[model samples]
Target: MSEKRIEELRRQIQYYRDAYYQENQSLISDYDYDLLERELKSLELAHGVAEGSPTVLVGGKASEVFAPVKHLTPMMSLDNAFSEEEFLAWSQRAGGGPFLCEPKIDGLALSITYENGVLVKAATRGDGETGEDVTQNVLTIQGVPHRLSGSNHPAVIEIRGEVYFPLKAFEKLNADLVAAGKPPFANPRNSASGSLRQKDPAVTASRPLRMLVHGFGSFEGLNTQSEVYQLLESWGLPTTKQFAVAQDATSAYKFITQLSQKRHDLEHEIDGVVVKVDELSRQRELGATSRAPRWAIAYKYPPEQVNTKLLDIKVSIGRTGRATPFAVLAPVKVAGSEVEFATLHNQDQVRAKGILIGDTVVLRKAGDVIPEILGPVVALRNGSEREFVMPTHCPECSFELAPAQEGDVDLRCPNAESCPAQLRERIAYIGSRAALDIEALGYVSATALTQPLEPSQPPVQSEADLFDLTLEKLLPIRAYVLDPDTGLPKHDADGNPKIVDFFRKKDGSPAEVALKLLANLEEAKTRELWKILTSLSIRHVGPVAARALCNEFGSIEKILQASEDELSQVDGVGPTLASSIKDWYQESWHQRIIERWKASGVQLEIPDFAGPVLTDGIFSGMTIVVTGSMQSMTREDAEAKIIAQGGKASSSVSKKTSFVVAGPGAGSKLAKAEELGIEVIDEATFIARLAS
Candidate 1:
């Protein structure tokens, strides 16, 4: 009788789940669904049902566009509360004297699983049981660490987070979409999900997606949620800064109400407050239904909306050569900030909305996020409204504009390296305080230096070009000067302001100014490899990644010689970025520029590091192959530690390999080690050897 009932309950539950998650149609009320799940759970417990029962799993169906992967632990949703009475009742029922409240971000759910501190898998929360693999896309997020910060952590852990697009980035994305002739995203949540699930990881990388860890899926060491939060901070993971410990039901309600009112002040979207038991033991004791943990509840708030007009559309050319479209709105306050410019996204968005230059448009801004042009006010549109069209040539460089690659919505300037606008930006970036710190030169001087040269002269297009510059040539680039005593324009014979470009005085002698710039250039040559690499303006190579590359290779020449596969072996330098780096070095123009820059005395080599050089250690002069995931640290960390101990950490196992440290998931490398008769050791023994 119980078996029959269980089977019947399963069928009904599956039907409801399919309707809610797959079809977006609710066949029953939330209360009725909860009752059904409760009945199923009771029957399962009484009859000793299998562990695979839906009573313990998640709801959403996995997307089929990518490879399907199973979750190590199910990512369950939270139960909802529509009012204070429902929430207080939940607290009383769960024995909740104290609880933790966090803002429930309205974004896509993601799971990042790390083994030995190295990020191994990133998947979306598909069905509670399965998800799609998006490891490459997750790597692109700067907030998601490639390797955990520090050591002495669990052997493995899975962090669950909400991947979101900040309001500002969302608005910018929409504007670019409008300018690219694409449809703009409706909201931050939708934009984040769509961007993260993109088939091309590079496309996803280009989007601004950030993650905030609020919980974990499967963790080996943590005992409580508070401990988890602290560990997350240590691991360099972002979390809600406004969480509070509510002592009782009333305090919890008060906190929620206060947060709800301040929601618009946040830079990202949040729909509700997630109240959960602080103690992991208490949470486990409370247990959970298949849909949500009994210890947690979401108190939802009403959505905030506003309306405004998009006055005009404009495009801006960025240094990377991507042509971005933005909206100029008639100033009106929205979401607590002054309203001026909102993003249309791209050209397709303009076409999608059928937006015209003079059309009254509906604009929305959630929180402190950048406002977006939702759509045109079709009812108010007059035929006088003009349609927007992307130009075939770049507005700044007049270079023929087209998509940088196939399947791209963005139209890019083909002459990024040589375009005056791009060059000026690049030069300024190279000279910025964050990079080489060339304090003597700034965007003002950099732009003046980039003015068109004689027909026969080499173009002054990059920061590297400045190294080849001489006092004789740059002295003539002029700026208006004022007399020091009078604070007025220094007069020439004709009563015009004296021109002083570079070091040039009214007398046309540029010697003093040229000396200052030259001295700055000399100082820049020795500014560490990481800074130099950052100043180079290589695509996708930011400060962190630049430092990683320099740490691995130690010299620009070595990095240039590295093949994509070899570059990919570096932690955080994935296939796409590796390909970009390798391809950049292969370009003939880049080759010429690098060679010229070197000849001009701009230092491109990393100085020998100062540290205790290990000698006569057991690992000294040894070639070791590290395969599989280590139990105590990341592969990159292990490799680094190995090198620190005076051993060479290699990618593959060969006959000449001195040792192979094999750990969990060891496969091909282990086989190779066996085939080659190389000495192999487990992680424990490997750690011991390193310690010795």
Candidate 2:
């Protein structure tokens, strides 16, 4: 290949790779991407290609949109080992014996920094040393803790780990995307990477991403690499349990081999196995090169591919009333499992691929990712082949599918309320963890409750039925069907083991589960008003906006009665959403559901939260200024304490200011308070007032 060709390939590969890994949106297939990268690598070796090729980069540069943060210690890359021989060579170079081997997760790398035993900063491993600050987004991650769990935590430490999207969550995310007429992500790693870099932290929080601590950057009171792992676990950080301490190359190689075999079985994706020297002192002595650490190595497995037939293509309607197309394939074994269905993404994707029915297709499955049709074998296509097309009308509701808005890709069915399929899915989203957080009410159970079975039971007609789910209605709700012979419930490609509630109980038995669920449903009815509002499936009303509405109106009645102008005044609730919220109440279906909910005794109003805030006590309506850092709490906390007792917290001290709470290092605000002849009190007096 020419130097120009290599340069073009390099930039193209990098852009697509970023879209794939960082944005969880892919522009090309894995094989196409691999071919481009391999071609660039080959040409670079021969032609001495241009400098700064993304092929040589560790990770994609942090997006410039976010504020940059530089690491105290440079986050370095590990040298690669494609074969056992290459890995064995590295083990020999490390001086042999006592190595730690853990799964090298195929996900985004992040650095989490803790100061004084509290998590203070979290950043992506951008271009190795420098990264974008993602502390807010990282805080929303379930596995990542805001505070260290144990008392034995390091005073100041920087822990490094991989953030990954689980397969099951990835499937749900892709389904939602498809429902919205958006393209599905290529794989879990790409999904995790893209989700973590979201500008809105709430968006990142909704993705099913988890972190596994593997190493540290700047640590105090830790002697060995093993201690780092132990400490991470003690601090309630998760680490891979499937690891081995190898004393020699043979043992290490054996563990890698074992992991390679078990890679497909993992819940999260792993590209390779990371082997590092056991001792921290030894790591320092071995030292690392500018490109990679000499003390550790990564043994990467080759990509797995399988050939299969694209039997048929079909479309499915989602809760959002968006149409998504998927392919039915002749069952073929991939990654040691039988696969049948794969997504074609959207109509644009189908046109781009030029795929036809009755064509031989190449399929590939990476660690824990769903098997995907790479492309069709044009040579193998016979005259019997037929071109596939997306339907003009909704398959479920029979309504004409139209683009959500002008030029939008998502083709949605306007029959959102009446559509049986959409209603079932919407109910599931209402009970989903991100919305109402109804315990044990997953998509399977939710759909089961909505979909009526034969002559025995009637389908749950509305949200009202959910609130009134008596024991009689619930006992027949199936979680999933069990395999008659294996006694194991069959799982989908994404490892969604829970099938939609068939008309029978699963291995756990739906009867006993119903008893627990009855109480759970009762508890769900009284959830926060914000949750109820968000779960109503109103357009433009997400978690953050819903919470803002709750803070503004404080009750369901107040929110519904709010004029469009008044609703727009709430922070984050724009004019568009305000209009949507008001219009939602106008819909006959919504009004019916509201009336039914009222009759069913569901909690429709926000709970009157009575605590700490002394409404009419002393300090009522007074403006209080807090300055400097208090010993017991921060300045913000001190100000919040004042506001809790029916007072207003002011940043500036003016003549009208009633009092100022001053602490050590109280500067301009304290001096201004004195100048204004405002009363100043110590933290002791402030605490005494709060107590009283």
Candidate 3:
């Protein structure tokens, strides 16, 4: 068993190493790969070490894309220590004491040779012994000086450094790429590596690349590691200002801790801190391994980016019938969570990313954000990988799919009224806090009511059927407890589709959820008219627009009677939105939804608006924009209040905006408000105004 596992680990590590070094891609996170390597080493120690085991090797060989150059002094990789224990162990082995610590920049390592104070050749760190020539590409980087500044420079000094893409510039570059309908670079490290190896120097120059000297390939006239950095800086080469000399292991660990806290604040991304023995004599005395020097070790932090296989690409029909393509990924842990799916956005996004089913893709999950597929590891693709072709018909109803407007990238299902998927999504949305606020009638219950198990009729067919679901209809119903995000049925440990007697107790009586849902649905019928309008799934009509429409027309009858021009005259309703509302009202099925809901005791009118009161309106003709989270009320409630007081609740801040309600965590909108010199008030002030 040990021998078999060792073989498997060897192959896996080799594959990942090749992906990282030769292909300019990372198939696994640094921390994960380290664990794998440690496991492989453990197993090999128990069993005999196999020939060509990765534990004895340095890195993958140079790729064929560039000319390979042998280094005068081989560039070795640093051993990694993931925890304090491991770092202490390494420190003890290396004869302990003062160490030089610097942030381990996540970038491509390079070795540049300067002959007689003039720049000559530059290469990538390939296989420790030989590296790929990237002289012209390296020269394109802005800050790299062509010639050394001081006359006291060595005859031939091999300066080792890292070429990195700035985090800020990386975001802009990715946004620009997406805007141009091109595949975005995966992460800063791979992006920097790929950029530095471009065939065209102009292409390399176009990218925002910077280099910071870290070490030297050939030691010449440098006594201490600190002196080496000072010498490099004197020669006009960029070196890290974040480096420090620590007295001992504990102090070094403190340095690592401090740097990790401010890692994101730095211009470049740092995986960890590199700890090296300070004195050159001690470093030489400690000797080196074939793969790494014994004097240096990198302490890696937990990774946010990982690579996972794209098992499939599936389209989910949303409440508004927008068909969004999402990737079904092989489960992988990233940023403290297990990620099984990542959104591809639309068909155009899938194409732009150049991803294929069965290909390994880079997955990134930052703090509290949705996991994103940066792009695919094209180097890992085999001929077996398949291109994802979006279906021309809706998977739920077999309705022909088309773009809502010409030249729009997203495709939509027009069977909004009857499609099971759309009905389920819309029903779930109606229960959302943004709509009718029916807490018990969530996605699971929505699915159970709309798409029950085989041989059982669905209790609710559409939003119209929601108010009419009886105990008899619900008690007998059984449905699959689907994945809320994908709406696909979940399976059990035995691999069969999991089914639940959704609205029933085991004894065939109505369940607690069923009772709660019924009560919630009954209560939802008496909600405010704007909430009812928002629950209809009308395109472009959110709470704000619904409130405006309700305030202007007072009733559903008046809204249906109103002309497009008349509807457009409402504060929040523009011409396009007005046309959409009119078009929605003209549909026969939509008319049935309104009539059936009205028949079921649902309120569809604003209360007590017998005469024009615009002159007496508290905020008449005012366009107020609310930004960020308020402690007293939600943005929706705030907007609703604005509409009730006869003010236009606008989403965008502009010169025409009357005032801006700013709260905690307000971002660009508040900035824009300040930039436009618009009147801005805090949540307290806005609440006072509303009360008055």
Superposed by TM-score, candidate 1 places the C-alpha of residue 241 at a distance from the truth, in angstroms, of 15
Ranking, lDDT, top scorer first:
3, 2, 1
lDDT of 2 by residue, 23-85 (tens): 555455443565677678778788874557765676667778788888878888777777888
Residue 338 displacement in candidate 2 (angstroms): 14
TM-score of each: 0.43, 0.47, 0.74
Candidate ranking (TM-score, best to worst): 3, 2, 1
Who wins the TM-score comparison? 3
* lDDT of candidate model 3 versus the reference: 0.85
- TM-score of model 3 relative to the true fold? 0.74
Tens-digit lDDT string for candidate 3 (1-692) = 88788889999999988878866777776778988999998887888776678987877788788899899888887888878999999999988878999999999889999999898999888887899999998889999999989878778889899999997688677667766866567678888987888989999999999999987776756688989888889889999999999999999999998776546447788889999999998888888877789999999877777888899999999999999999999999887889898888898778767778998888876544567887777666678999899999999999999999999888999998888999999999999888999999888989988998878888788777889877888888888889987989889999999899978888888899889888998998889887988888889989987776776778877877789999899876889988888888888888888889989988888678774335336887899999876787888888878877878889999899999997654667887887899999988999889778
lDDT of 1: 0.73
The 0-to-1 C-alpha lDDT of every candidate, in the order given, reads 0.73, 0.74, 0.85
Instruction: List model 1 lDDT by residue over 1-692, tens digit each.
Output: 98998988888888877655433333443445666777887888778767657776676677667788788888887877867888989999889757888898978888889898899998988886788899999999877889889777677778898999987687678778776866555556667887888889999999989888988886655666778788888988888787888888889899998886556546787878999888888888998776688999988664333344566777766667777778767766554566767766668766765567886665666543456665554444557878787888987778898987899998888896778667766776777765788887675556556653333233366655778777766765654443221122446888876654445676777666567877898888778777788777778876555666787787788888988898898765789888888877877887876787788876777667543223345787788888876667767567756765766677777777999987654667886787788898888998888777
Candidate 3 stretches greater than 4 Å from native: 1-19, 25-32, 43-76, 81-104, 113-118, 147-159, 165-191, 198-303, 454-456, 526-530, 543-574, 603-692
RMSD (CA, Å), each prediction = 18.9, 18.2, 6.6
